[model samples]
Target chain A: MSRFLSVLLHGFWKDLPPFRLVLGLCPALAVTASANNGLGMGMSVTFVLIFSNLVISLLRNVIPNKVRIASYIVIIATLVVIVEMILQAYFFGLSQQLGIYIPLIVVNCIILGRAEAFASRNTPFLSAVDGLSIGLGFTMSLTVVGSIREMLGAGTWFGMSLASAEFEPFAFMIKAPGAFICLGLLLGLMNAFSHWRGENVIQK
Target chain B: MDLVLLAISAIFVNNILLAQYLGNCPFCGVSKKLSTSLGMGAAVIFVATLASIFTWLVYYYLLEPLGLKYMQTLVFILIIASLVQFVEIFLKKFSKPLYNALGIYLPLITTNCAVMGIALLNIKHEFGFWEMVVFSISSAAGFTLAIILFASIRERLFISHVPSFMKGTAIALVTAGIMSLSFMGFSGMVN
Candidate 1:
């Protein structure tokens, strides 16, 4: 049970995807311009991560050694399509909001990174736990960045218009450059917190 | 005239790294050194051009004809994976100097989304064959340009004193943000 819990917690702070490992930068930056977008993108990645981790864990033995990476890509791509279609079918508006990042998720190093690193080696149950933890961590990072971007850029938190009429929104916060800057600052803050906790010090 | 504009626009206006944000893994990872950046840029240009052209054929001839267009993500990734694998072997065997230059990065481009992104955009925009080739090449040129410029800045950064927490990827990203802001200047230069 402790092992399972560790696998789950591992993704949250220690092995966090965007902030710690910096694995999934593309979507971490792209869809994270708004709080709503951040949550939606994170959830979609979580869904794909859980299922792909499970399937890859199950097929670990049967897949040929040489072709494993290829096999993994195919499996991941198929799952991304399913998630894309489902999102399109039910959440039409979000499908538009997220846009190409959905299909682009297929190439997200985080998904493939986990499949190769954790899922390929561990048991199915453990793999699922790992996937959930990492997905949550990723989701948290995206939301934090998105929320900050939204609040500063648009004077809204999840589109609520929190700021008064006199408040001047920093419009650049939602632009492409703003995404990079917001994420960079947030990442630095996370690192400092971790450092205060006496964890690993960030080098280049 | 429009072709020239499209080429210029893709390279600078919608530049792959700063503007579109694809292939950033390599952008951030390899841009620490100008040499590696040049090598990666060259390799990506080669693979992205060929992969886009080949994937175009596959998409139009194979996938769309059979109504398997939904399988594009899967198919294009598979194609890119194989394409990079083939290029790795071909470069290693034929050109020793070139192989060493692109040694590590060749395999990395397989998963780089920029190559696949360009292929998808080609189909998405429905470029003609010539237009497609030109777009692929120029987009890659754009990628190369961004990465090389980043590498030079990162070289200076290596000597500068950065905040500890913001050291590494954090500072790199912040630097890229500033660069991206600069690139936004080109937004209306063409259209």
Candidate 2:
């Protein structure tokens, strides 16, 4: 039970997708212009991650070692297709907002990384929990980044205008450079915080 | 004339790495040194162009005609994975020196979103064959340019003093952010 709990909680901070592990950065950087977009993208990825991890864990014993990576890719790609169709059907506006990044989730390293590292070695239930925790962690990070960007860039949080009408938005926060710098600074802050707590910093 | 503009736009205005946020894993992971970044850039240019062409053909000739457009993400990924493997084997057999330079980066290309993203973008933009070729090549060139420039800067950063917490990826990302800001200046050059 402790092992399961540790696996579930680790993704929140210790192995957080974007900040700590530094995986799946493409989608993390893109589709984060607005808080809503970030949440939407994160949810899509969580769905794919949870199912892929569960399926991969269940089939870990059966899949040939030689072709495990390819098999994993196939499973991940199929789930991404399902996500794409579902998003298109119900979340048309958000699907358009996410654009290519949605499909690009197939190549997102976080899903593949977890499948190869955790799911393949663990049991089905544990792997599913890992996926949920990691996926939610990823979602949380994206949402935070998105919220910061959206608030500063548009003077709103998740499309809600929280700032006064006289407040002028910092447009750069929504641009390409803003995404990089924002994430970079946030990463630095996380590391600093961890360092203060006497934890080993994320090296790379 | 329009082809030239498209090429310029892809390379500078809409850089695959700096602007579009594709292939960042390699951009951050393999960009520690100048030599390796150059090798990665070359590998990306080569594989991305081939993948784009193949994916373009597969989409237009196979998926579109069969009305299986929804299978795009799945099919494109498989094609890219196999193509990278084939390229690795073919390089090893035919051109030893070429293989040595780019061999390590080939496997990584399978998961590089930049290659797959360009392939998807080619279809999304509805580009003809020649247009897709030009766009892919230029986009890869753009990726190469960004990484090479970034590596050069990062080499200097090694000797410089950085805060302990921001010594590695954090600093690298901040540098990339500034570089991306500079790249944004070229956005006005095309379109």
Candidate 3:
């Protein structure tokens, strides 16, 4: 039980997908223009990650060692297609917002990284927990980054205007460059905080 | 003229790395040194173009006729993985020096989103064979250009006084942001 618990919590902070592990950054940067988009993208990734981890863990024994990577890609791609269809059916606006990123999730690295590292070696139940934890961690990071960008850029939080009408949005905060700079500075700040607390920062 | 504009736009305005955010792992991971970045760039130029061509062919000749368009993500990835394997073996047999140059980077290209992203974009934009060829080469060229410039900047950063916490990827990412900002200036040149 403790092992499961530890596995679950690690992804939250210790191995936070985008910040700590530094995996799945392409989606982290691309679809985070608005808080809604971030949440949508994060949820989609979470769904895919959970199922892919579960399936990969279950098949770990059966899949040939030589072709495990290819098998994993096939599984991840199928899950992404399912998610893409669901989003198109129910969340058309967001699907449009995310654009190619939805399909690009196949190469996000986080899914593949987890499948290769944790899932392949762990029990199915434990792997599922790992998936949930890591997926949520990724979701949390995207949401935080998205909230920051959306609030600063559009003076809104999840589409709710938080800033006064007089506030002029810093339009640059929502652009391509802003994604890099914002995530960079946030990462640096996290490192500084980790250092002050005497925890060894995960150097990516 | 339109083809030239497409090339410029793909290379500059829609840079696969800076603007589109594809293939960022190598953008950050393999960009620390000039020599390795050059090698990776060349490998990408070679493989991405080939992958694009083959994927385009497979899409038009096989998937579209069979109405397997939904399988694009899966098919494209499998094609790229196998294609990378074939290229690796082909290079090892034919050109020892070329293989030596791109040996390490070839395997990594299978997972690089830029290769897959370019394949998907070629289809999305509905480019014909000639247009796909132009777009693929220029897009890879754009990737090469960005990484080379980034490597030069990162080399300089090694000597600069970066704060301790921001020493590695953090600082590199911040620099990439500035570079991306500069690249945004080209957006006006197209569209």
Candidate 4:
């Protein structure tokens, strides 16, 4: 029971994608200017991750080992295209908002990394759980960073005006430099927090 | 005149790493040392130029005609991977000196988002043949320019006493943020 739970929840802090593992950072920085954008991008990734992991796990034995990377890339890319098409069909606004980053997810190390590392070795059910947990972890971190950035950069939270009118926002918080600095500080704070508790934090 | 403006824009206004957030993993990973960064940049310049052109051709002539445009992301990635593998083997067999310099970084380019991103952008912008050619090469040149500059900045950062907690990636990312701010100065060059 504990082991099952661990595999599911491990990605929250132990293997947080951007903060600890540092995988899937392109979207972490690119679409995180707003909480809404962060949530949208994270959810898209989660959908791709979960489905790809399941398919990979199911076909683990049948597919040859030598060409598995290529196979995984194809599966992931196809799934991403499906996601993009769906978004374009149903969620036209978000499809436009994410733009290239949607397709770029095909190269995000996290999806391929997990497909290679965890899913290839585990059962379909277990792999699905892992994917869910990790995707949720990614979603949480992105949302937190986005909220902070949006709050500071535009005086809003998830597109809602939080600050009173006439308040000059810290516009820098949404720029490229701001994204880097915010994530850096967040990473440092995570390390500090874990260190104070004597928890081992692996920086990948 | 258009080509010149495109070159300036890709290098500065739309600088691949700082602006689009592509190729960041390698940007941070291989950027610690100046020499290695230079090597990575050169490797990227070569592969990116070639791969972008190749993908552009494939996308337009093949995919457009067959109505397989939806499969572009998959096809482009496979092409980039095979191209890198082909280059690795060809270089190893032919030019020992050039191969030795770029051998290790060839495989890494397969995953660099800049290569993929540029190919896609060229299509999205609906660029013509010469326009695509100029854009791909110059965008890659822009990536090379940003990486080398980042490498130098990181070299100087080694001397300073960074805090214990903010030792590696934390500090590196913060420094990149500062560099990003500086690059913002060029946003108006193209427009």
Q: Model 3 over residues A1-204: C-alpha lDDT tens digits?
A: 889789989999999979999878899999999989999999999999999999999999999999999999999999999998999899999998998899999989999999999999999989988999999999999999999999999899999989988999998989989999999999999999999999998475
Count of steric clashes across candidates, in order: 0, 0, 0, 0
Docking class of 4: medium
Best by DockQ: 2
Question: What clash pairs does model 3 have?
Answer: none
* Recovered fraction of real interface contacts per model: 0.74, 0.86, 0.68, 0.65
Kindly indicate the candidate among 1 and 3 with the higher TM-score. Answer: 3
* Superior by TM-score: candidate 1 or candidate 2: 2
User: How much of the true contact map at the interface does candidate 2 reproduce, as a fraction?
Assistant: 0.86
Stretches of candidate 4 off by over 4 Å are: A202-204
Q: On residues B100-187, what C-alpha lDDT tens digit does candidate 1 reach at each position?
A: 8887898889878888888888987889999999999999999999999999999999999998999989999999999999999999
**Best-fitting candidate, scored by lDDT:** 2
Instruction: Assess candidate 3 and give its TM-score to the true structure.
Output: 0.98
Q: Higher-DockQ candidate among 2 and 3?
A: 2
Error of 3 at B170 (Å): 0.9
Model 1 misplacement above 4 A: none
lDDT for position A23 in model 2: 88
iRMS, model 1 (angstroms): 1.0
Classified by CAPRI criteria, candidate 3 counts as: medium
Which of 1 and 4 is ahead in DockQ?
1
